[model samples]
Target: MAGHGDSFVDCGCSVVGQAGGEAAATAQRRVLARTASVCPVCLGPAPAERVAVGDAVLLVKRCPEHGEFSAPVWRGEPAFTGWVRPKIPTARRGPGTERALGCPNDCGLCPDHGQHTCTLLIEVTQRCNLRCPVCFASAGQGGGRAKGLEGLGGELGGRPGDERHEGDTRASRREDDPTLGELVARLAVLRPRAGDANIQLSGGEPTLRDDLPQLITAVRGLGYPFVQLNTNGLRLAREKGYAARLAAAGLDSVFLQFDGPDDAATARLRGLPLHADKVRAVEACAAAGLGVVLVCTVARGVNDHCLGDIVRFGLARVPVVRGAHFQPVSFFGRYEGFGAPSGASESAPGVATAGTDDRADDRKLDDLREAARITLPEVMRAVRDQTGGLIPLAHLHPPGCEHAQCSFSGTFMAHEDGRLEPAGGACCGTGGSGGAARDAGTGGMAPEPIPAALGAERARSFVRRQWRAPDPATVSADTDGARGGTLATPPRDDFERFLARAGRRFSVSGMAFQDAWTLDTERLRGCCIHVAAPDGRMVPFCAWNLTSVDGRPLHRNGAPSRTGVAGCGGLGSGEGAGA
Candidate 1:
């Protein structure tokens, strides 16, 4: 829609003649890019347009049968246009499998993909100890099915290879859990195929597996350079020796879910009041010499207000707290709005109710409503406001690995006294349309711009260093033959020298993933974070979790419908689901 007399268009007619023609000079929301999107109603491809809607941006699309739809893709100052840091698109490395269907459906990293894999997530199990109401994977203790590496391979198409089990045991395996041997076989295939991929061991809760240490050891044996565990931190808090055990097993880092600073916020997002447990978990990892990154799920009017506090807390922990990743809540499995009526309780602001038809398709353009949560830009502003302008919005690096609008990050040097000094300076792009704060002097200090050629490598290096947890027991020994020949450790004196050259650095990052409503195929093409599927396919993260408006999954697990999508079925244990 153009600003030419459309009902949705407003040229700021009231102030057009003011501000020495500044208002008159400004253009109304206009189309920026044409791309492919999915119809939230039918889950089919739709013609979409990325429009500069004032200071924010929105993705609008129309389905032949489902009418027009729109969703906010960017918000706040540093206009959407400014955040883009374009790079040369890489040529696809041949489709690993036949193109079964276009895009999303044929997610075998089909030769059409525009980005290379950076992080490969392997879901070890579908079972989770805590069932949060806003689960993207809808994981639980009793409902979902589970699969091992071999079974996962079958889902993709066929097993990687017909290799027999080597040194396997029944005690280490559960009904739905994968045997250590099966997992090793699966990774063995992925190791060389993905090429120097960073692996994250994920599950309902990776801590649930008793053989988790052995699993980590196997992945390390696969020669994966970096290995991380995604967990809720319950076990780490309760079991004083758990962190040390993981460190011994060669696990490099922990992606701990820390929603907010208060118990009320935690109860609202997670199922229980877990502030104390979260704190204890971080302390445990610190004592065990494990690095921790706090992963926060920001819900509007829920824990969104706690953004700055979370950053401060993360920085206060310094070398131990490596980073804070904020993810705005996206509607998918188990979402009923932040304060909507359900079993979970907290003194929320209010309840959000749809029309009489609770399951009405919200994808229609006429029915579009504002999401009830903070966005990436809002979080960036919060960081500036709460931190006394020490870290302004520009401090965040523009998108590099993912789509320009998908996320933002900033790296900083941390001191023991809790002072955070910007390490790489302001490393973000400015929306072509000038922003309110573009000339605000960025807290009176000029930012050092990161060169385009060095941006990606610099960002990757920082993430690698910040997220790695040094294990004293192993140092840098080659535990298995898979470790690329040999692993080397720096001497204590050498380590001190490295620390002096580059003090402890931490990243403050935010990723706003797309849900079915906002699944943009153009953005999908540039996704670098992928999940390893059983059939030897590498699926993009958002596409893997995408569910129809009615709750039928397009990839991985079959989910029950909230609006009655056909073929939807109950998820059972071992389904290999993830959040």
Candidate 2:
């Protein structure tokens, strides 16, 4: 078994017993645990097992109709079993819907859920400005809704009562952009249910809306404390004072879609060269006193190798560039040629890359899919390896709000000398009882259960305090001097210097969203980030985005109804929000 500090490698671990002629490989494997999953082909519930082989863990499941599926969930260092953060399951209070179905099928935040909402995403529109090859929401112009009858119930599968009448015309079923009045009504209904959970305004591209500032104002007016916009910075870079207008509207931060450090990385992932626009957007946000978090969609052989460069770039911007968040690509919405076995090219122009050409063979394609995945452990190791251990594996801890395996995050203090030192606090730990010695394979000791509600609250508070830009009034003059600006008077003492440096906190984190291929019911049940559906139910983020291999959605464009709330008629008539 390898340790966290070991040199990063593919390890080439495969699913041994998943297919015939691999009987010899099964002898070296071990079953670690059992859980529930959904078939990637049929979207039906399937019993699954976590199998450990070499230093990796693969999620293996067999659908009665769709056969077997396996994908790597963890790889390389920090050991899968040891990375545990146990939370006492929070009882679902005031559930939005009754459990007519089970687990994911009954995902209106049914009583079976194990965690509370930390961030509630509201997709404002489905119309996007750019066409990225790897979009989870599959956003587009003219709306991404299907044509004619295909756009209704059968293709866009949903729970009961989500079906539209056959006589409904294409004009009637059109996924229109929600009006300001409709959004306000929906928010009013969700306010009592969501409490103070952070609000993220997302869409095809949120900046596309001219009345975006008004929407932000409405969110703030409704008493939500923090509101962040999810966008690609094209508009902010092209239009002067755009960021300032958003700031004036009471927006706290910008979740900028920043793929990598250079244009080549952007071109490969996002269809065109966008590095310059991303930089200008950051500058605009900085000028407007708005905090920005650089979000990178990490795809294998694309931007995964540049994680270190992205972090270094964010650090150079300091308080304005508050954090860097990485998301490993999941095959759900518009990934045309993501995991295709060799020779298949991505649908986006010039965005194509190498993949296995085994599409004709189902077993071979499954093997390729397993090979293409870049798991959470792999991402943690990449950060450490690419940054030359500046962000050590020990410093990165499992999440407190979401499932332990879903993400990892750490905060570092950036000093004038360009060193990133770990700002260890309650969030940093092996999450175990006492100071027990870590096991050889698992990175830490068995975790002791903490209150799930406490974890959710703590995560919400941390993001609110750390993700926002440091107040200009409290920033010491020495801080400006550190960034090459002149200081009227240098820090008088070491304490002042320490205070100045402490104010420059930079966060590094990565989240692995489960796709149909990797949908773990246990993880889904414990999800903290949720989406606010038009029908007034808070659906977990993954559940809202989950799609089968054929591209039929489980919840996206779900039929909207007005039964739950008062005064909000014609709700769910339009498309929901996304990022």
What are the C-alpha RMSDs, in order, of all predicted structures? 10.9, 9.3
Each candidate's TM vs. the true structure?
A: 0.75, 0.82
| Count of clashing pairs, candidate 1 | 20
Per-residue C-alpha lDDT of model 2 across residues 317-436, encoded as one tens digit per residue:
887788899998887766644543121322211111233332223333344445457998788889989999898777777877788888888888887688988776424222332111
lDDT of 1 by residue, 1-579 (tens): 111121131212222455645444345647898887765544556678877745666777765554566567766666665565565556445446444345565566776676666678887876565656567665543221222112211211112441111211111124677667878888787765566667888865678778899998888888887788888898899886999999899888899999988788777666668799899888888777778999998876787777888888877665667788889887655454432222132211111123423222222211222446456787777777877776766567556556667787777776545677777543222222122234344433222443332433444445566687533332333222221111265435766545532425777888888876577887887787788876677888898777655444666542222332213332111111111
Ten residues in sequence with the least summed lDDT for candidate 1: 162-171
Model 2 residue runs over 4 Å out of place are 1-12, 15-24, 142-175, 339-371, 426-447, 478-499, 559-579
List the global CA lDDT of all models: 0.61, 0.70
Q: Which segments of candidate 1 are over 4 A away from where they belong?
A: 1-27, 141-174, 338-370, 425-460, 470-503, 558-579
> Which pairs of residues clash in candidate 2, taking residues 3 or more apart in a chain or in different chains?
82-442, 123-577, 123-578, 124-577, 341-355, 341-356, 341-357, 342-355, 342-356, 342-357
